[model samples]
Target: MRRLDLPPVWLLLFALAVLVLSRLDPWSLRLEGAAVDLAAGLLIGGGALLVAVAVVQMRQARTAVLPRREAAHLVTNGVFGRSRNPIYLGFVMLLLGWVLRLGSAPALALVPLYAWVIERRFIRPEEEALARRFPQAFARYREATRRWL
Candidate 1:
């Protein structure tokens, strides 16, 4: 079987795990408040928006967004200029929103874990490939942008 290096797959797995663990209510903090709900909603919405922007930028650049694929161009504008890995940042935000919605402190731990795994599994290699493909441009972009913002 092909190894699943897709960040979305990992996101889904982590999200499902959070959902299941939240339902279990094991050592969970059930904070019921309108503020919490609003925050969660904002996080989810903002994260989705960021992901959309990143994907659209990549598409416009005619570059491959998938980690396993080769990129056709170096996209260093808009959201890409702000964060080199906006999609991953968006994914983290989505997970954080879910954690807040569930009010599960244990589930909160998954956010960092998700970020670390994504960085090691996808981001690092993709950066290396980007550097190889667009040496000077990638270096400049890397210097100008934060990896996750």
Candidate 2:
């Protein structure tokens, strides 16, 4: 299949934006007591864990790598068994975790925008490529696992 045309620079830019948005807002939005802290911790920690898992899976696949520009294989095992786009999910979780940490409604404004760009620019084309490369297996995997958590 033809490789998707996403730029590595854009991914880096988006990541930087997420980091900045998570921390820069003046309003320190706090969640109510233990629940907020717990959820924030979960989102941050889970996001970190998912990133680690994705990294390990990338090493294993020696192919199904990131940025939609460097993909080499159609990975469908390990973390890929659970989520089709663990890296993207990790990123979203990280963003949400940041919003939780910031508790700033404005900071959260970035989440949906991020999701939209990711879904359109990264996810859709990747799905198309996967469908082309491993039509049968990809369909089966799609049936089994979710696109996101």
Q: Using TM-score, give the best candidate's number.
A: 1
lDDT, candidate 2, equals: 0.74
Per-candidate TM-score against the hidden true structure: 0.94, 0.76
Q: What is the C-alpha lDDT of each candidate?
A: 0.90, 0.74
Give RMSD (Å) of candidate 1 vs. truth: 1.2
Worst lDDT 10-window in candidate 2: 1-10
RMSD per candidate (Å) reads 1.2, 4.2
Candidate 1 per-residue lDDT over residues 92-124, each given as its tens digit: 999999888887767888899999999999999
Off by over 4 Å in 2: 1-32
